[model samples]
Target: MTDATALVQHLNSDFSAGHDAVPARVNGTASPAIEQALAHPDLAEPIAAALAYAVVRARGAVRVAELGTCPADRVRPLRRAVERIATERAKAEAVCGPLRRPAQRASHRLGRSLKQTPARAVLPAAHRQTLVTACAELGLHADAFSVPNQRNGAWAQSRGLFGSVPSEAVRELAARDDTEFVAALLHDARMAEDERLGHHLIVERWNRLSATALAWGPYAIANAERRAVSRPLHARRDVLDALEDAYEDLAVLTCRAGEAKYRAFRLTCQVRELTVTGKRASVAAAAHRRAHELLQVSHPEELAEIAEAVRAHQVDCPFRADGCPDCQRVVLKGLSGQCQEAPGSRPEPTSPPQPTDASGPGVTYASFGAEERYAVLNDIPGGARVVVSDAAIGEDSALCGYGWAAEDGTTGHGDSMASTSGEAEIIGVCAAALTALTTHANDEFLVLCDSRQAVDAVQEVEEHGDVTRAQEAVLFPEAGELLTRLLPYAHRITVRWLKGHIGHDLNEAAEALAGLALRQARGRIAERTAHRARARTTSRIATQYLPRRSMPHAA
Candidate 1:
């Protein structure tokens, strides 16, 4: 039979006779993956057919054969059965408007199935018709209410009078079509937990019907206008002048302060803003073009002329004159502070070393080398003092240490920690900061840390009240907590970044302490690991054979 004729014959058959139809999951809750599959345009026909079957079963109007039914009982007529299913689907399409793939159809039967699913409480046929009519006038399809799993509670609650809606409220809502009915229904429900639901119910239905039409209408015109004005290359001076005059004309037409006037004002402001941005962009582009031209000129004389022109136009040269080979030959002649293009080509100037009172009596760090650069730090009369910290990570363990040098002399501390190198650095800093705050109450604090990231994390906590930059520096949160608690005690707290492994005495002392801590942490980790291995071996040996005392009695 032809497809059309088969469809008609199926509609004629009695769909309400059978009682074995598969009911789809109530409320159309298809999994995200299945919904994505159904949304494919190629699968729409099969999906639609499935939904029609589901709808018919839900309506108590028809039933199809159960899965794995005997051939003898199900072998009546294959052609007639196909036609019946098709006709029922056609009826569903007429009521639901159109079933788009990806959108879960309330009638989808392939996913979850529940036995004896509860039906929505019935409204009078007349009231239902009235609601559908009101919805159509507001540009919504009636099928939106019936699609997917039935939301019976919402309907029942909205209607208010159990099992039926009052004639008076229905009349009042129907008379006002612009959002009043749905708003009243939502207010009655008091569903403040998710405010978007009411908006979604109304907006999705309208959007489905209007999206395609609007794509080529006002949307297209607005996009074209925005592109012309927003791009530096596309915006012409003449065109912008014309727009200014046109804006004035529009303002004259909408002189009153209402929606139209407000819209015109906003449009005028956007155009003016874009014009300023476009002019700046044009200037930058011209500068780039001139730089490209200058870069191509190999001769020093020609390049000099180009550079002069660039300066006359108040544009800075893109290349550094001291560093660029071409510019260096012409522009940087006989300048005392000129940079050498290549390293070691010229001797760079250095400042004279400052005088120090290292001869004053003070305690010395054993870790410092005998070289003069590693001079003993004298006890300086000041409100603040310095502390240096370091951390080292090994293959099996990590550790940290800190050393403080104040007016009294040098004092050091070290400890094993279960963390990476970065965390160790931060923890070391935290230890030093804590010691300084507690020991020197009336003095300012200066902490020097080796790890740059750790130093930044500490500063971040001091400034922002949080550590956001360094993720590897795990001890930052603890450091932040300690700093926060110690803020009241210290006169002033400062964290500084210092290069590691230098000849600085305090830093060298901290390095030695950190190495000692790393060795201790590694030994502890090894001992624990060996203990666990031995325990496991002993347990296995003991369990290999059952005890004679615990054996079951012989039968």
Candidate 2:
């Protein structure tokens, strides 16, 4: 059997036998290897705690498995129990100072006899204080546990004193084949305690260097190069080879960062294409996962620029034809060629634009069929028409707009000038619901909106059944007004949250309409401002140089 397995069996037997002195005896008397481990002051408590915790966890796992729980589900309760015990121990230590070393106390008392001692007699003054402090903190009376020989009942009942070990450390220890599993168990204990035992400094320094080298950024290459040139040589050939492998990974990452970015962009495009074409959810999700993996190592700003270029290409060249110059430019140069400015004079791109209107010529909106609607509104009565609403804010202007599209092909959009996107979203949902009420007053309407805040606000009003209170609590007067108007129709309207920018057909259409409305509103504002400017200039010139007849001869 593995050392860990044997240790578990030994602990189970000792605990089952109700031996008050097992905590002390198990460390040294169980096996020669364990005895040698306990000889080190740093390893004693950690080793004992690790063994006890492992036994408790193994027992719990076996119990849970017999109840037919899955592996993932089985781990949660054991983890929670370990965490609880650790928290309690920390609190107790904070109040009464740390628990006395049980192994040391037992050794001094036994004096080579190694006979079983009553657990109550074994408790040092500090341990008693800890138990009392723990009980007081938990609001339990201390007098209930004055029994003569209850073998450290509190510690045993709490399943030992160790904290949880991270899965990464556990997996790494398990992967090593040269050492006994007991050594792995010792390593896990030290890791959990976060104690700096021998060789810890070397491991910590190497980890820091590896993290810096692997972190993808401007300094990654330099850090990798420094480590490759200056890393300390180890006596073991295997350790040296491991360092070499890490250096190679860093080298590969640094050398291929640009290529990775390009591949990520292509993958993103593929995912978007698949989503917009009404492909299977699983297929689109898989593509998205692949794209996300590549995105992790890429620079955020670079990815944003590429995404913007792709979006612009989708907007300007609706066909997205392979041969189109703009499409080719986006693919080859990673920049949109739509601007007339020379390459040197072109302004650096800003933040990515919001999702554009999908109603544009080349963009296709995926259908949200009956199956999708049913999935979202399984509780709501059937045969209700679906309306998806979205809002957009101008990038450079304060202009905002709301758009909504019904599955019945009815669509509406309007600008809410000088309002924030949050207010615009509520206004959009209100407008969509009101429009639906006008057309199909008797029909139930399910409004799928992207803004959770808006949905929550509406639900709040419904729950409280007070429009005046909602008006007082709302941030924007316009939103309050729109919501008040839709309040009476609340029974017919159901507002549900839908994630924005995914390939939902009606939602995309609404998003596109909202964006289009904002752009048009911005254009109109610009036109009106230019007209006033021109008129003012004309009047100024007339007064200065057009021979203004001395203010009409003072008439």
Candidate 3:
């Protein structure tokens, strides 16, 4: 806020489209706060941008046509007006070397931000034109990464899609993954509204930052390459932190977008409120309850659309009561049509199996099996996954070469590479509770896991056990041969075990993030990932749960 020091002065006053807006009624007035912020320098622009993004989003394409009373036209006022701040910052830096631009340049930067650099625009409804321009600009500037043939609809729904939230649809403000939000908001809205919102939803919820954004946003490849080159854990974490921060404003923009959708479409209604933890099961129940309430509405255009969408995604037209909870979102949507029943997969026959390990001396491994519904966060597969279809294999980045699993699994042999790390596929992963030493040298290394087996070859203590163990390339195998070589030039190195999803917070977050990144990379945007984050509510009220069925668990 180079212009206003403390707060935004006249947020709603900037637009003169002649609409009746009772700002005092909808968004509470903060004149005193605005006046106070006017005196501060850093707060105005971001706030203004956030406000502007909210407006442009409210005004969707087909602006007044589809918007009707929605006033989707307002979505562009500020986006059309704001200056290209990111680019001006770049040019200013070219001359000033790290110092911010002169006040005049910044004013021009914020005055018409979208016009100058359309790629940085926050309005999802304007992504098509902006993305084409962005592609052209990147081609001229960074030919290596320019998106040439990419089309719009990554934001707006394409043909045959009912609808999805625009890239600007905000779920959480101050979210860690904001880059994808920006990418969708500024570039993909032009996507035919038919493609629906699934792709953007998945990515926006999961991957806010990407290697592409880092490489292209006001930085050079040298900086992007450094992301791969850094070894110190702190350095890597800092880089991630900076990328997450780069698009914090995107969340604010999306918040406005979600509000806009809720207002204009009126697609959802609350029939009842339920008290529950922040989990998929809880959220799904909430969605179901909302859907049921909307069904009773006299005039529910949005609810009808959702009903059709739900039927199209469900495992069966009406979900079976006794079935696996782990179901695919798309399949569930397909099955959720005009049925009036509890949602779940169709029941299948199960054959009895032998049991032994259950009575073993002790549990040797973490035992949470992979559950498809709760595939992420849980160390082991959840029961939900048991009912999932194998055909729904997601094009996740972890399945690609970018995730830690892929990196760990890489192996080199006689001019060939292979994936062999059993560690990557281990279920119920837990950490070893021990740390491995790191080195200074940035050379890549390998893990020869077979040597650990050699340690078990001889358990009894012997005088020459240590010497004999070192001779063969088996017991303490890799360590014995490479110990001396690693001591001299290494700066930082650490041997870490990825325990099966044994409830470690960081590992869970990473796995969740990786799944999200995969969806985004695969270009599926509407897959919303519901995580256990605290909700944003001005008031905290609790609810009591009542059973819908009389003998809910009776045989």
Q: For model 1, how does the per-residue alpha-carbon lDDT over 1-555 read when each residue is reduced to its tens digit? A: 865444333322322211112111122454443344434443333334344434322221111121112253453454344455556556544543344321222222111111000000111233235435544554544632332222322342353313343455344443544345334332322223222222312222222222122111222222223333344433344443433333322222111112222223233333223321343334323332332333334234433443453344323445544323233222323221322232114555789544333345433444335532333344323545566677665431122333333223334455534245566677777777777666655667677777777777676666665444444355324444555565454337677666566666556656765655444332322435544543443343234322412322111
Models sorted by lDDT, best on top = 2, 1, 3
How many steric clashes does model 1 contain?
6
Worst 10 residues of 1 by lDDT: 112-121
- For candidate 3, lDDT tens digit of each residue in 3-85? 44211334333322111122221244435545454333332233333443434323222122211222446545533422332
Q: Please report the TM-score between candidate 2 and the true structure.
A: 0.29
Candidate 2: the clashing residue pairs are 357-512
lDDT of 2 at 92: 31
The better candidate by lDDT, 1 or 2, is 2
Residue pairs in steric clash, candidate 1? 10-84, 27-149, 28-149, 39-101, 39-102, 106-148
Candidate 3: regions farther than 4 A off: 1-184, 188-257, 260-555
Model 1, runs deviating above 4 Å: 1-382, 396-407, 416-419, 467-472, 475-491, 524-555
lDDT of 1: 0.39
Error of 3 at 530 (Å): 34
Against the true structure, candidate 1 reaches a TM-score of 0.27
